[model samples]
Target: MKNDAKTRDELIGEISRLSHLIEDRLVPDNGMTDDQLRSELGLLRDLAEQLSESETAKVLEKPAPSGRVESYQRIFANSPISFSENDMSKLQTFFTGIRHSGISDFRWYFEHHPEAVAKCAILVKRIYVNQATLQLYGAGGIEDFTDGLMSIFHEESYRVFREELIALAEGATSFEKETVVFTLQGERKDIYLKIMVVPGCEETLSRVLVFVVDITDRKDAESMLEEMRKMLIRTSSKSIDGNNSKREG
Candidate 1:
């Protein structure tokens, strides 16, 4: 079990490192050493081979899923509201660095170091998303969703979200807000979102779970209702004033 856990950790780390490499490639870079790239690639190849020979066999021999597991699977696969899970360790590290630098306000820090904020955006890793999330964003699959993740988020919403994440790292349990997002097809959407930090075994935040509900129609309805209410009030006030004026005459 100890060896299995260690191997799993190595695999996760390598996968995350590879993701960072891909993100780095999106921008101009000094370039990585050929030896370094080859070494990491070799390690991944070996891990994949080991998993296919041993872990795959074990999984194949495992017992069938129980009713509870099936129920959870069904809900995750079929839920109407969109949900996503993000690995937050990279984000936590960024916050830690800022805090140690004597930066108290994230907004000030971001404003002073816009380039750092832009780089930090790449650190956000979307580990999983449900089917509803795919549908909501018009994403064909996880790959499609992640390819344009940064573009999908409104700039202001991204800043707001980063602030909320910093609050979570500082001991807040959950955060919620109504923010704007864009679909893969570039349609703007109003979303009400709730984010909760999932604690690790050591009680630190391991992951962030985001629950998103599209509220565009609801917002439009509320705006129309407010306008109608104001109009009615104005008309009623006018009638009351006319009655008072007639009585005075």
Candidate 2:
């Protein structure tokens, strides 16, 4: 037990150190190579995983829960889908600026200015997430989950997702689309996302609620079915050609 505690403390210390390194390396003018930055992030992820295992074991060693803990235990802690709440005030402001400039699709602007999205990522924070989010993203806690947001999305998917989010913030009511998200362990999952803006009592947008459903299996099945259909069509065409040649002969 003493050794376990010592190891846990060491892991925590390493996690903190790596986190600082990651922050420093992410600066635009930072001199670190991409490989070096990725290496540090990888080490940080490993340390976080070890810490998570230790904490989970500790929780399991405790007695059965009661009261609020017991009541909350049955929530979406094990659900297959992910859900998150995000603040969209900054996005709304961005939309307002674009609308003033008569920009129909803000994607072009954002693509040209990658820093804009990064800035928005800092301002438009994700405030809450369900347990499934943490499990899906392999996050130890909400802080870890939020910190990994930029790295968790595929490049193209992130761009499209941002565009749609901006549109929704500009009074589009709701938005839904399929995109790819990367887990903390670097596994990619195709997800169907539904985003809705919740309005306050004053009839103004307050927060955005997002639902992320892992649709990787469904997408793969669809692709397989499409391939089978194309194959069947090709076979039928060949058979028809063969019969015609026999009739001609």
Candidate 3:
């Protein structure tokens, strides 16, 4: 028992250290690329998994101090990456009910019943949006953002949401995807999104963290490079054809 507690303490310390390291890299002009961000997040994910073990859960049963809670709230509010808290308890209940009804193969069931997937998505409700999330959707505040929520989601997002529901049904604690979204003014943006069920909240799914990173600029650069490559290929082909024609003449 002593060893278990000691290991849990070490894991918690490592999580804090990595969290601070990631935050430090977010400073301006740090040249932090998406890959670097992903690398750090990957480490954090591993830590989260370790912390979710049964022994660690027993060690963390007590609530955090008020001051520590306040500190975490500040970090979420000011983080550059958009973040939102969601409640998926209703969806969790729905899954349980379905299982009770003998729906063992969720993937096959959802595939055959598309409407069920949509219903599951609607069961999820947004509980809170941080400052970065409000700005990302060009909203003056959370109220405006909530009111205009339907306007911001591109049609493709529903497809991504379906995949998320499927993953959760299959026992995945996290999901990630690149998706399209629109601002209130109808400007399109490409973003990479990741959603994780808070480790302790996995049972109820009452608090899920949704992370959004705008990737429009990166995507645009890739598109331009692709077009340039095609143009060069065409030019080279035309030059070769001309050379062949001249030799025949």
Tens digits of per-residue lDDT for model 2 on 85-165?
676666677767877888877667777777777666555577677788888788887787454257686786667667775
Backbone clashes in model 3, listed as residue pairs: none
* Candidate 3: regions farther than 4 A off: 1-71, 144-151
Rank the models by lDDT, top first: 3, 1, 2
TM for candidate 2 is 0.56
Local error of candidate 3 at 54, Å?
29
* Cα lDDT of model 3 by residue, 1-249, tens digit: 346445534544544444344434333355744455345434333433443553323323432342343333455677656877778888889889889999988778777887786566557677778887878888776666443235576668767777887788777878889898888878898887877776677788777767787767646644633554465556668779889999999
How far off is residue 29 in model 1, in Å?
Answer: 65
Kindly list the per-residue Cα lDDT of model 1 for residues 135-217, writing each as its tens digit. 88888887774432475777867776666755665667578778889888888888877766653411344566666777665
Listed in order, each prediction's TM-score against the native is 0.59, 0.56, 0.67
Instruction: Report the number of the highest-lDDT candidate.
Output: 3
User: Which pairs of residues collide in candidate 2?
Assistant: none
lDDT per model vs. reference: 0.61, 0.59, 0.65
Runs of candidate 2 with Cα error greater than 4 angstroms are 1-79, 92-108, 111-114, 201-206, 244-249
Kindly report which residue stretches of model 1 are placed more than 4 angstroms away from their true locations once superposed: 1-74, 100-108, 111-118, 201-206, 237-249
Order candidates by TM-score, high to low: 3, 1, 2
